[model samples]
Target: MKTGTVVGRLWASKRLPELPAGALIEVQLDHPRDVIVCYDPMGCGEGERVLITIGAPAAWWFLPGQQRVVVDALIIGSLDEGSPPTMPK
Candidate 1:
């Protein structure tokens, strides 16, 4: 999983039938300083830090039954306010 902050939301008039019920949010990644859109089911708002899962894991975890969903990235968890624990140097 990767950590990022929710920057904004995307509105689409049309979406695939296979897609689940959720919102599409733009996230700014902590490392590499990149922005990406992710499927969000937790109703995360802007400025909230989130944890994202990508690729097959995201698709499988978010989808119900045995159907396939076109999810390149999915918001798995919302982060709390505070710095994460650091590893030993």
Candidate 2:
């Protein structure tokens, strides 16, 4: 899992059928150009620190009988900024 802060939301007029119902958020990481669009199941908002799961693990997180989704990045949880001395970047 990766840690990052939610920066913005992405609105897509068109998307693939394999994509599931979720919000698309922009995450700001360590690198200057490391902002990435992620599928949010936890309903995270801007300025919030989050935990993201990437690759096949994110795509296969659904329950049994659910369709296999194609999520490259997924927001798995909201992070507690107070507990961590170092927040993302």
Candidate 3:
């Protein structure tokens, strides 16, 4: 999974029937000027740091019998008020 911060939301003029119903958000990665759009079912808000999965893993992460929605990036989890605990060296 990749980590990034939610930057903005996307609104399409027309909706696709095959796509899942959720908010499409823009996430900014650690790389300079690198950002991507991710599908969010977990109700993540802007400025929230999120864990995302990309490529085929993202599309398959849903249910088995669910329609095959072509998803490039998906927000799997969100970081809370504090940073994640680090493992000891």
**TM-scores for all candidates?**
0.84, 0.82, 0.81
lDDT of each: 0.84, 0.79, 0.81
TM-score of 3: 0.81
Task: Give lDDT for model 3.
Answer: 0.81
- Judged by whole-model lDDT over C-alpha atoms, candidate 1 comes out at 0.84
Q: What is the C-alpha RMSD of each candidate to the true structure, in Å?
A: 2.8, 2.8, 3.6
Give per-candidate clash totals.
0, 0, 0
Q: Quick one: best lDDT, which candidate?
A: 1
Output the better candidate (2/3) by TM-score.
Answer: 2
lDDT of 1 by residue, 26-66 (tens): 99888768999999989999989899998898888754774
Could you tell me the TM-score of candidate 1? 0.84
**What lDDT does candidate 2 reach at residue 26?**
96
Candidate 3 Cα errors over 4 Å, as ranges: 84-89
Residue lDDT tens for model 2, 1-89: 77788899988769877787669999986434388889998888888988888798877776454566777898888887653425343
Q: Give the lDDT of residue 17 in candidate 1.
A: 79
Error of 3 at 62 (Å): 2.4
